[model samples]
Target: MDKKTHFDFVTSIGLMILSLVMIVDSYRMGVDVGGALYASPGMLPMVLALLLLLTSAMLLKRSIRNGGARQNLAGFVAWFDIFRKSRMAREMMVGALILALYTFVLAPRLPFWMSTSMFMILLMAILKATSLVKNLMITALVVGSIYGVFQMVFHVPLP
Candidate 1:
């Protein structure tokens, strides 16, 4: 087992625990006596919790069948060794940081379209999306489509 598989197992367990907590919290939120199906405050949480539970279960099963214990037995040093010179690991870390920056820093400060377009372009570049023209086209199309759906169709205000 390598870092990817080990990380998958760890993430599965963590998400399973998170979903269990969410389920409990949702139950505590209570069902409304006068509400229609899924009209209660707990409805969304319950749905998300179940989806997380189902997906994490599948991930755990797959990870266990794919030498999960070997990674566990390797210890932190061995795990660290796996990514000592890995460009992909560094890229992934940077990608995650970029995503965090987009969500927390850019999304709130900038207008929705500009922030989203910048995020899409940056992410595409990081992932090595085709030529420059193609990247811009994809980013514009995605931003336009999202803007159309939310602003025109849904008539929702964006940050």
Candidate 2:
């Protein structure tokens, strides 16, 4: 199999495994107070697991149907090389990771403006942004805009 097919096969297997874990965890949650599917604590997780299973199955089916036909490992490797050499892609990936970490980990405890400002500043620094004035201005603009939207307009609590 070519690299693309191999990667897809592996991804399908990994998704199937993750789905199994989700299903098991949901099952282990046991019965809820009312013994109703809707009221059960496991309902959401079970639903997510079933969705994951279905998607993974579809991926696997599509991959098998395509077979090892037109995919070329050499071309895929060339594409990977292009991506690896792209500074813009790398910077964007770093920015995304920073945003994800702030959203998933820091935002829960830190104040919204504080965490977002820090994340924006740190991400700009990582991207080797020139002009300290520009960096600070951009950071303030983005962070303040987000804060205003969430806290002032939406009246959402900041954590």
In model 2, where is the ten-residue run with the lowest total lDDT? 67-76
Per-residue alpha-carbon lDDT of candidate 2 for residues 17-52, written as tens digits (9 for 90 to 100): 999998988977754344767778888998999999
Best by lDDT: 1
How many residue pairs collide in each prediction?
0, 1
Show where candidate 1 strays beyond 4 Å: 1-74
Q: Write the per-residue lDDT of candidate 1 for residues 3-120, one digit (tens) a residue.
A: 6777777778899999999998887776534465466788789899999999999998888888755555364346777675689998898899889989999999999889999988
Against the true structure, whose TM-score is highest?
1
